[model samples]
Target chain A: MKTTPEQSEQRDGTATGPGAGLGTRERIVRATARLMQRQGYEGTGIKQISREAEATLGSVYHFFPGGKQELATEAIRHGDREFAEMLRRALESRPDPAEAVLAVAKDVAAELRASDWLDGCPVTATSLGTAAHAPDIRLAASEAFERWRGLVRDKLLACGFGAQDALELAHTVINTLEGAEFTAQVARDEEPLLIAGRHLARLIDSYR
Target chain B: MKTTPEQSEQRDGTATGPGAGLGTRERIVRATARLMQRQGYEGTGIKQISREAEATLGSVYHFFPGGKQELATEAIRHGDREFAEMLRRALESRPDPAEAVLAVAKDVAAELRASDWLDGCPVTATSLGTAAHAPDIRLAASEAFERWRGLVRDKLLACGFGAQDALELAHTVINTLEGAEFTAQVARDEEPLLIAGRHLARLIDSYR
Candidate 1:
């Protein structure tokens, strides 16, 4: 099991240590993702990203010449890849799609709790209300979601499920997990996500 | 069958005409909710609120001395009540709880599409990424989620689901719908929500 830099940063839960060793561009993108996870796109600023990454403001602009919007798209892509990696690992951990889906929910709940509810799905937080105004941010978020859904769909198809069932249930899995994560974060409790995991597992098993 | 000011405003999908006739305080709250639904809390500003509400800055401050946070709390409450009304109607529309749950998702998807995806759930838009920082906004959002969960739990209980089953399914219902609504908004398509509706209905039917 090889751990990517993004995975290590997520496990470390902060942009220090190995995160600091990453290049300035990677550091800035990671910082932006972390900030947007906590404060959202509009709430996060370049100065804060520079401060968080321990990089100069000039470096942030040097990497992201288009400024915040461009940087946010990259940050979202970073978040997207991180989540996809986690999802892939979870799905591979079990031969049964039901078990894999349950694993994802459990893993997500644990990670969110470990982050003290601060590390939400960056894509959802950044793009929640920006769809009408920020096309790039919204597009990045949408792509992230689509990618996750695609992964789930592929796994379900690899199982015995039909194509239509796999597609629709993939949407259900992603939507339920997304919603459950938000509820769990707000309540600062893991019950919602845990319950979602159990029921979603049952739903997936019924298809078999 | 009677429409309250909030219901009318939601139906109108704008803060004009009937929205204007509402008193300034109500107007301000409605405006805040609408803006936050599209732009989120941090992205929405006081001046923008005043402009949308057609109220003076003095009047806005006079009504909510705690400023944007206070006003946002009220706006969340406004959104909460409006959603409660919709949920109540949806739950009451059919004799079977499963049918009712499906109806709720359908109605929400239709409403989001009608708003051109600008009108998202106010509590979610305002509270995402802020739970760790904004206690007041976080509390309001938490209350709204709890209230919605209670509505679903009560409906499930009335349908003869065991106490434990009702409670857990209630969480699933809200989490899935919330997630589905978000995905639908980002995709500018209703398939996610519609799939969620079908799957949830099937999930509920499994209990029977």
Candidate 2:
């Protein structure tokens, strides 16, 4: 679910520069990311990925020799990279740390709504379902989680919390958002996210 | 993976009522819960469930005539029941609310480790992955979540928080635990649970 290129290029409408905006490899990965984010690894198939990416089956095999496992792992890693950047942009813009945390939750909820709940955390289902069989995917997911946690901790530290306190708060931030996203998607309502935001805001404020 | 019949029977070795101790139907459901809890919906197969449950294919078909979907939805629903009971018991024994919360997290973490991380929220991955394909399972999961949340809110209220505040706190408590369990399993460690336990304890104490 880590769509590596978070910028969401226009998909290079014209075939003039096939490799310019998003080449064959990029398309396959992006398509995999999108599908995996929604339906997860087991729910998605290689042919579907090839079709969605608009890449020829031959090209998909060419780009990913190991096929779905390789393709999904790469897709997840790509999503991991892009999401970390998205989180940074969402959180860094707000000057106040506590406010920034709440903003991050709400902003992510908006993103979920924008994607029609198709994109929660690329890693949630994708990792849990696939990790037992694919160690590489598990490692990628774990790394992505650590990256997100580190960012949240740093933000809290900047906001004047002690290191231990910041670490704990950081965990709370990610944990609530992750669970909230799952519930929101299941219920097909954004209320869970908003509730999470309000409760998280109170939790953050209680730091005083 | 709702484990119904949550009174925690000792697995009646020599059933006074034959098929009561580890009955074929119950075994199939329990096996499905374990497999689905770890591997999720699409990742688990009926044959595997049959083998794991030590039941014949005919018996499996007899128990779950509708096959995988039927068995899985039943499994998740069963897990929901069992988990609600587990949550109730975990949260009920302690007199001090904050300490109870911490103890619940720790006890569950211990349980997760005992199962080698195979026993996370029974419906977590199962519900998220199948809710789109099966609405009944989704409803069961939502109902189970609300039931659990109500229990937690009641606990918080008993601990002296206002009704509104208790509701929000209950949501946070569940949210954090769900996400932390996912992370801890993926990372193959219990630190996330302990981290969540501490943060949740502090959050609970803030109300006082």
Tens digits of per-residue lDDT for model 1, B1-208: 1245444433343446447557678889988998898889889999989888877798799889999889989999999999999999989888898889889999999999999877877889988767777898988988999999999999999889999999999999999999999999988898998899988988988988
User: Scoring model 1 with DockQ, what do you get?
Assistant: 0.75
List DockQ, one per candidate, in order.
Answer: 0.75, 0.55
Q: Which stretches of candidate 2 lie over 4 Å from their true place?
A: A1-21, B1-20
lDDT (C-alpha) at residue B166 in model 1 = 92
Q: In candidate 2, residue B186 scores what lDDT?
A: 80
The deviation in Å at residue A41 for candidate 2 is 1.1
Residue B25's lDDT in candidate 2: 80
